[model samples]
Target: MKYKTICLIIFSLILLQGCVAIQSFPTVARAGDTVTLALGSSDQINIADTTVTYTPDGGVAVDLTSNVRSIFKLYPDRASPAWSFSAASGIPVTSGHSASVDIMVLDLPPGLVPGTGVIRVQNNAVYPIFSDIPSDADVAIEIVPGVGSPAAFAYSLFGNATAGNFTSLEAAPHFRIKPDFEPNAWYQAPTYAAAELTISGTLNAAALAATESQVTGQLRIIVDEMPTSLASQKQVSWARNGGDITINYLSPTGKMAYYETTVAVFFAASNYSFTATPNVSIRYFDIDGNVVTGPPVFIKSCTNATGCI
Candidate 1:
């Protein structure tokens, strides 16, 4: 009697989870800000080579590159540097692992139509011991339609310098900044990308033309980076052009890296924290030098708040 050969193959994608779960901040995220995909650790799957992708709501798929093996892999419950606020996301892990990624909304690959978006994660087998481990997961993220938010972020203008404390106009607009993540562990370093902020507003061109003559920095933009019990700040120096002032900072690549930081932007006249009247705009940008997110800050003058002096 002769016996025949038999083969059995297991499909991991069919057994794995793609849209595991997403835990993001501010619930509602605007363009230019940062959003997160809360994929648990990698130890659960027995091996670690995973990939990330972004598919805008009503758009195409975008590949997100993350190399864990090169960045230090974490086991179940073994906190990864990028896992900031992971517990809040409720990632699935008992025998499984999860990882979290923080991405600037604008950095996301442009969606086909720009409506709803999804983040997908997949684990591939890199060796024989890790074979048959092809699995995938998905998470949801909503992209709002406009750039400027109605948040409390504001700015103050100071063209008329009074003993270094500029006596200027003020305006506040909506603003939300993506905070930076810190990875205080071995082999953990967050990646950084450039984030540029454009500060602009209507000037009493007439008043400015008369006394101050231009919308220059007397009271410049301010940066606030804080933690629960600790806090720090700095004044942002901007490159000014008539009514537009540009501020730039390189944001960390992800929440995964250690020894990195992030901050928010605000406007002030000189070094003094003075209030402003409405009539200014604030916006955000990408490395491409385009407006990715923000609203025009509105400004009003001490002499006139509307229609140039």
Candidate 2:
């Protein structure tokens, strides 16, 4: 009777071993990175009659049984405004134990600001049989902004002049400017007239002529007094009494340099009675002395008599 009991116990132990022989899936991924679930030994396990299903915590889950391997992928649900993804084939796990279906996350989609999400993986071979083989992993992503390029100057005008310079007497001469930059760089918009203008006005013929003469004499003195680190300097003289005016610019080292064009305005006494419009083109430069080469922006100045539009 005892020998019979020992045989029965051995048989029961063998059956128990078979029931526990089923292999379990493993999860792989970084705390803040993408999740990849790998089925190490799908061939060694008795999954011929079973299907494996996985569920991600914060990303899209894909089945691995479609491919020839046993590898699955999960995409995180993070936000990145400028993120994007590309099409990818399934990653091979083993020779014949690869994923039945290939799954991949495209380049992070643009406009995914940045954040964290959860990813989960599970097996759905047989309902309630091995369905409890679910695993979860955390995923995190970060997005950063790009740098901006430099800009250049096209044209500029300073001081008062006759209305004939502009297309419309009603519209003050507008200055158009541009900047140079790379295709995808962030640039701080420049602020105009931020620095107060120490001098502004329309001088009559006599006044203009006198100012020009004085400027010629004072030019040397001014250059000697200016600091060496200065980049460039400009001085404009406009006549209100229907006369011609001149503009002179000096470089940082006190030498007369012509980096820009000049326009001469002749204002007659008759033109003085009407509103005068001056056209100016301004160029923006960075600390490195590089001109911005972007689209041009317009700037306008008008007198109260022009209906103040």
Candidate 3:
């Protein structure tokens, strides 16, 4: 989804139980992009002692506490990394007033790739009893292909096969559709056909051997037809190549609505190989045929004689 403005999600830790609000700019970005997290601690807790963790889809989490950048006051009245205090630079001595620090600049990995990445911030301050220790704040951002790579859609997808049923998580990026009620909308007619989806991925050697280098499957696409409202479903056929496949179709369209789609592909194979997990990615094409890409998903192969778990 395109985040035009700051989207703040509040969370209270099960242990500390304090409100922590994190705001990330350019939630949709590419490699070499400088992303900032503007944290607001309403519970009057210092955010400097917070620990940040970055975890990408299907990847391990890495701590980024030391990556916090140092900043100075841009103006005398306000500081870049400012704090609200009552007396000294410590806690508040009066009622209804507390000490708090806001805004922390972070240095993200320079080699970020196209995928859905998560940033989690946990307050690590050791406070006195009854004092607030803000809870963890997590934000997931969609990373599109960088410059020189394919143009990306407004949304991305992540999928996996379970019991031969490949399904995407509901948290996946939503396929945005402008309301048909709007004049000059793409859903008017001809332009709708221009919106398309392409599923592409490469198969491992074991998968190739199991399917005799060819695999045909049925694809079920479920689209959130209206922004976050009703859903629509469609079915289609897709075939796999010796070690790869790329299937394209005219994506579903709606007027005055944003669309989110989840796909499932079924391929028949008596025995599958677990030697390697196959990776899959989905791309969307605009009315002008401009391509937009998202992060890929990895499917686990079932090598057991019984079948996939």
Candidate 4:
């Protein structure tokens, strides 16, 4: 499930201190799509102690060092087309055994214009803080026109086998259907086309409350099957409740689904229903306010009559 069409660009540079490699995932990106730059060193050199910069085509070099951000008056650059490290993500890691940092470039609404750029990393040059120095390396990146809508829909369905255990049905107890457990609870139709679901941005409380009880919770989109902080879960709510529930991604973040990846959608929601079958419809919209991915749908059938639908 690799997005192979967008190749990984690795640029290596040897300096007197040590060599460094800069790798960009999905070398090609859209204007408003978040991109990741993986900087790895031949030896252990904490990227947090160094300086990072991004120079857009024909533009001045933008300082990407998170620590020096205050001195440089830096803001999230990529979102502005000028290019800066993302705010939501932290700087590269630092440790004796690790020599890599995954820099996340968050794209805000109406993000950077379609263009080219180079990301460079080097020493921070501060006194009393001698550390492993990394050589200079430039990773080229190409940003194409923004794809305002999601490209595909991918999701998994979870069902509660015993719905009668609780007074009301919430999303907390639902488990994604897998082969090990009650496999029959999870069913995918032959016509279904699975796509990754990108649930970014802040939660829509008003919209969520209107759909169900004032019940507001958060949703976390697990990518590459990695775990994130529980606090990072942004407020989330279903669009509606019934045997079927719809989750809409038309929030301000305007994130699109990434293609060719495996992702799991995890969330805690308010009470919905007590039906025998629960269906989830995840929808995305294009720039024209039209639905894309045809709204990938997944359904979980409750085996027990009193199970949470």
Candidate 5:
């Protein structure tokens, strides 16, 4: 699980005629998100390879040198972000297919997220080409929630595990509501101290006898870019910066669970700033039963711990 592929930031310099005719172009990225990888040329050969590596996720499996893209119109100097290697930097596939290069998805850090982790590739110039994806269409890549954005609650180490491809297993939520508003728009939670957010403890009993499904669900809050199931938000009074509340759960077998839901959120008369996206999903059964869901642990809380809460 170490496919850190965010390389190549050339400014302008192309000339590597050896073997790697650049191929395999289908890169769906996340983990810091910054994508653009189109390497063509299936067989209409016009050689000149660059370099690329990092393929870990079950290990060894490569094939990418399929070229067919190079027309040379020559005209790309967008404000000194240069990177052109002759042959018009290759881009025009159909003979054998290959032409795409815009990589930038750093380490993919930050826990793992909602589930879905893998970024394999193989085409380090000079005759390299590795990518087999196609088990029926290899599945495990979901990070889609953009409308203003704010639905990426990371930390999924593959979530409890059963095989992969995310199946859903909640219980990683803990929000005492009311922080910063104006995200999804529609705020009203001022009944003095609103309260009414009761979730009395009980994650003990050896994790409530190791679940199988009953891990509960909602307990939301997410303003910036919306999605706490649609912020419309409400957590009224007491906002001395919602005094100390941190969340992060998931312990069906996936480990790393945490909680701290004590929000009263003082400081009304609002301009909004909230953030506490919880969804709670932790169904289990790994003794052999095999149900697994775990992967909803997000607690980037905010009550002015510096401002951008």
Candidate 6:
């Protein structure tokens, strides 16, 4: 009876040993998330070939690149540089039969588009027994937009007062003219005396005797005397055959100094009209020769009309 009891006890111990659970440390990680996997010492398990596959929940599986596998082996205690399958490190049992592996995901390059995805990790080993295991993890990425900076305004003048005609009295006076501009940008325009007559060199006979002196010798003048910060009104005038003709002035800044010159010719009547529309074009550009914006600048015959051309 005692011998029978001993046999039964030995059988019970063997059954208990078999029932002991093999602890599995399984983890799921996103493409950019870090993870760690460990096995107990008694398991005598070693990693032979490890790989991670990615897919959307309902999409097809795609193998993780060797670059990604190499990144996973960078952990000092988790991987052996000398032993690898593909890019994966072969985990070895050194002092302890138990071992742990660490994995990490890096940021994707700008070429990758934002998307939703999932990942699975697998381990194939011989010493411990080759097995494929998978765990589900989610991935989320976002794309940002690119924007350009605002451009600056440029200034220039086009008239008979260029460098070539600098010494000639026939040359028109220099006037600072601001182009029509957008908000928060800079501009300049001519300033003239209000209700006052300013004299310059007398008009030549060719100009004085012309049928329309106002149009033939007309000068488009500009000035920079104004503060460029305030809006003010000024008057412009010139003598034709020793008679005063009035022109209109509108500037944002209060007048600091006056700018004036005679048009080469004067019309017989103040109401004399032109065959083509008289208009000035204002163009804005940046330092790099790129056009920024533009607006039409009009000049009306103030001697007759009150509005702009």
Q: Write candidate 5's Cα lDDT for 27-67 as tens digits.
A: 34443443323332221111133222333354542222221
* Model 6, span 1-309: residue lDDT tens: 674585344333322222111221112222333222221111111122445555544567666533231212112222323122211121121111112222223222222222445445444322212212233223332222332121111223473332322112111212212233222222243332231223223444444445544543554333322221223443334333332233334322334122221122233343432333233333333334444433433333321111112
In terms of lDDT, the poorest run of 10 residues in model 6 is: 89-98
Q: Which structure is stronger by lDDT: 2 or 6?
A: 6
For residue 236, give model 5's deviation from the true position in Å.
64
Please give the range of 10 consecutive residues that has the lowest summed lDDT in model 5.
223-232
Off by over 4 Å in 5: 1-85, 89-110, 113-118, 121-309
Off by over 4 Å in 4: 4-19, 41-52, 63-111, 122-135, 147-309
Give the distance in Å from residue 161's predicted Cα in candidate 1 to where it truly belongs: 25
Answer with 5 or 6, whichever has the higher lDDT.
Answer: 6
Residue runs of model 1 more than 4 Å from their true location after superposition: 1-19, 44-48, 66-113, 125-136, 147-309
lDDT tens readout by residue for model 3, 1-309:
223323222211111122233445557766545455544322222334457777889888877666655311111111212222222112222111123333444556556667887888776333323333334456666667864222221332355332311112111211121111222332322222222334334444556665433444322233321121112222233455555544444534422111222233333343432233434555555545676442233232222111122
Q: Can you give the TM-score per candidate against the true fold?
A: 0.26, 0.18, 0.30, 0.28, 0.17, 0.20
Give the Å shift of residue 173 in candidate 4: 29
Tell me the TM-score of model 2: 0.18
Question: Candidate 4 on 1-309: residue-level lDDT in tens?
Answer: 345323221211111112223445556677545444443322212234556666779987766565221111112222321112221221111111112222333232235556788767665322111232224457777767857432222333475233222212222333232111111221221111222232233234443444334332343333321111111122233333322233332223332222112223444444322223333334445446655553343333321122312
Alpha-carbon lDDT of model 4: 0.34
* lDDT (Cα, tens digit) per residue for candidate 1, span 1-309: 111111001111111222233533233455544443333332212112446666776666776543111122222222422232333122221211223211211233332234567666565322111222223445666667656332222334475423311112122321222322222222232222344455444333432342232334343343432111111122234565554446655433212111112222333333322233323334444435554542232232211112111
Local accuracy of candidate 2 as per-residue lDDT tens digits, 64-151: 3332122222221112111111110111111111112212211222232233332333332221112112232222222333322211
Candidate structures ordered by TM-score, highest first: 3, 4, 1, 6, 2, 5
Superposition error at 178 for model 3 (Å): 54
lDDT of 6: 0.29
Error of 1 at 88 (Å): 13
RMSD of each: 21.9, 31.0, 21.8, 22.2, 23.3, 36.5
Candidate No. with top TM-score: 3
